[model samples]
Target: MTTAYISRPASAPLVGIGWMVAAGLCFVGMTVLIKSVGAALPAAQTAVLRFALGLPFLLPMLPALARVRLTPSHWKLLSLRAVLHSAGVGLWFFAIARIPLGEVTAINYLNPIWVTVGAALLMGERLPPRRLAAVAAAFIGALVVLRPGLREIDPGHVAMMGTAMLIASGYLVVKRLSEDLPAEVIVAMMSLMVPLGLLPFALPVWQTPGATELILLFAAAGLGTAGHYTMTRAFAAAPLTVTQPVTFLQLVWAVAVGALLFGEPVDPFTLLGGAIIMGAVIFITWREARARRAAIAAAPDALLSRSASGPAARGSSRG
Candidate 1:
């Protein structure tokens, strides 16, 4: 067991950085696609189309699933994650169709904050003072983004908030299951399950998409698939602490695209709020990395002490 633990390859911090880049690109592209669909396409239909087109990329992974084994607990957890992820997708699509692209992207950052809180509450993970403070800072940033008191909050904003919460919860669940399953299996299951779950809702108002719409839909799906694949590779190579900070780049990309592509205005408040959220998130990740390093350093010494106290040592002492 010790040998196996020791043999686990070091996940490079740079890998995490790469994953962040991929994720940023994927999300920015997704937002652009959503904006292109406009209010003409039903959010549900757009979501269904996104997943449907992405299905092909996952086909090759189906065979790998056969080699993989899942425990009952893993199945249950995966099911929960699938549900949460699907709902989050639905909510996000609705929010994007209704809200400004920059605001939507800014609010989306709340997921990391929610994940931190969920980790503490659900996973019973320890949260030091710095993390707690960071969480508070994040919440404040979200409030600024929403600005509920100054403006009548749109239902889409609420939906986006819900989306963030659901995705964050799903992430914590994925982290719980990461030790047992390969990333591909998890990604494949999500891609497959999203369309399956959306089918019922999609059938109600199924509109035949235009040729241009179809092309955009396919492109969105392809980007999403590729983005996730790159993200997985980065994560596999690096630690979350290294990747978490780079996700901010996505916000920048989204803001630029929103302005240039969609004629969306960049609000100063959004920038300020986003900065607060990013700062808190960075601090939280840094603290966690430091704690992880300390733990790893202490682990070997603890193991050696235990081994030195084995029964053979008592026999030698008696002799």
Candidate 2:
């Protein structure tokens, strides 16, 4: 039996971090294009278009997809994850169109915190006091960003909150499916299934996209898909703990994009809040790493469970 993670080559962490940085740049570019498009189309339709346009990228993986023979449980989890992902993507599109780019990216830092809370409350995991405090601190960070009572809460803010929670729930299901399935299969299945899930919602609000809109959407889709690929490569290179911290760098880009592209001012509260939530995420991930190491020590030669969530680690930030 092999370990969950093998010995790394020299500079593996740096290499993994380099890929993570590349992925971040891709995601930032995708977000800029999506925001540039604004709300030209309904969120559901926009989401469907992005995924539908992204279909061709999956073509090369057709053989790998064809070889899969999933049990009923796998189908259930995949379907469930797709549905959650569909909703999350729609909400994300809507939110990004309406909110400041930096704020959108900042709020996204809460995705992992949602998963941590979900595990404890829904999955019966023990959330020791420290983890519990971290969750509380994460929420405080969110409040700082939102500042609900101090100002009128935008519908976009509401949508983004739902986006984080929904996507995190999907990650939970992805975790189950990932155990026996390869990451490629999991990603491909999600790519194919999410559009189908979004179809019903997209139909009512569908508007024919213009040439310029189509070209921009296609570009955004390509970048987003590429980001997912590079993120997966980062995971394959090193553990989540190493790449996870690198994600905070995206906030820097988002802030720059917001200021330089959209004229959105730099909000210090958003920056501080993002940092706080990022710290909580790093803490949670560090703990997860410790737990995995202890488990490996207890059973050194056990078959490694394929962690289903390398890209999911960044969880819809690619949008």
Model 2: lDDT equals 0.89
Estimate TM-scores for all models.
Answer: 0.89, 0.89
**Could you give me the TM-score of model 1 versus the true structure?**
0.89
Off-target runs (Cα >4 Å) in candidate 2 are 1-11, 298-319
lDDT of 1 by residue, 168-222 (tens): 9999989987888987798888888887777787789889899888888888888
Q: All candidates: CA RMSD in angstroms?
A: 3.1, 10.6
Tens digit of per-residue lDDT, candidate 2, span 131-166: 888899999999999998898889999999999999
Question: Clashing residue pairs in candidate 2, if any?
Answer: none
User: Compared to the true structure, candidate 2 yields what TM-score?
Assistant: 0.89
**Predictions in order: lDDT:** 0.84, 0.89
**Considering summed lDDT, which 10 consecutive residues are worst modelled in model 2?**
300-309
Q: After TM-score superposition, what is the CA distance of residue 267 in candidate 1 from its true location, in Å? A: 0.6
Q: Against the true structure, whose lDDT is highest?
A: 2
